[model samples]
Target: MGRIAAGDGESYARSISTSSNVEIRRRTRVTDIAQRVAKLMWQWAAHIVRRKDGRWGPKVLEWQPRTGKRSVGRPPKRWTDDIKRVAGIR
Candidate 1:
């Protein structure tokens, strides 16, 4: 094992194998690529849904309850106004 300086200027211990380090780096890259692809897929799916019904789809935006506020278990439904505008819905 070896210690390396982290972004926060703290030394963290990690495995000393070169192969392990390479695998970790590869996994990180793969995760980033997956995230990008997922975002693109979501946008395409949302576009298709909106085009089919002239209305925003369920996945376009999600509503979350206000922080530190009491409310029902389900958060209020909301739309992404920005996305709506981009989609020229309204």
Candidate 2:
């Protein structure tokens, strides 16, 4: 048995290791998930546009809620805003 003391007046009991106490940490590779998501969003949008079925996906995407009063702060960002921005159109 061994006592591990810290500078904050805290002590902990640790067992003496008969085996190796080495810790191995491997580096994680970063992924471009944002790019992949954006690509997929564009593909889905294209598919929805090409659909002949009377689905509401395209309609909902273009739909806007009309109200008499407006909030004080900035308006919320819409999904189509991102798609339009990425498509290089205003």
Candidate 3:
């Protein structure tokens, strides 16, 4: 294109910032609140999955014992493993 800076230096080219908006907590945006809730839920899910025995929500999420041996490498991936990967959980 002829115009190299067509969208440059223009506020319209920028996405809306969540921090600038006020939420019910008065200091955060709705997305922030939702994110906090989601993280908390994920943490709680980990806790639930750690239970020894139960048919609760997270029990299904947790990986189960392997009837056979695994290869000489990292274990097979689980849904919770992926969640932890994206959520930055330990």
Per TM-score, the best of the predicted structures is 2
Q: List, residue by residue over 18-42, the lDDT tens digit for candidate 3.
A: 4345543464324566778768877
- Highest lDDT scorer: 2
Better of 2 and 3 by lDDT: 2
- Which portions of model 2 show Cα errors greater than 4 Å? 1-30
Please provide, for model 2 over 1-89, each residue's C-alpha lDDT reduced to its tens digit, 9 standing for 90 to 100. 24445742332212222322232111233446786799899999999889868889889789886777977798878889888899898
Model 1's C-alpha root-mean-square deviation from the true structure amounts to 10.7
Given candidate 2, what's the lDDT at residue 82? Answer: 89
Per-residue lDDT over 33-85 for candidate 1, one digit per residue giving the tens place of the 0 to 100 score: 65677578667756666675545554345544468966759655444554465
lDDT (Cα, 0-100) at 9 in candidate 3 = 37
Every model's TM-score:
0.26, 0.60, 0.34
Order the numbered candidates by lDDT, best leading.
2, 3, 1
Displacement of residue 41 (Cα, Å) in model 3 is 1.9
Error of 2 at 87 (Å): 0.8
Those runs of model 1 whose alpha carbons end farther than 4 Å from true positions after fitting are: 1-31, 53-90
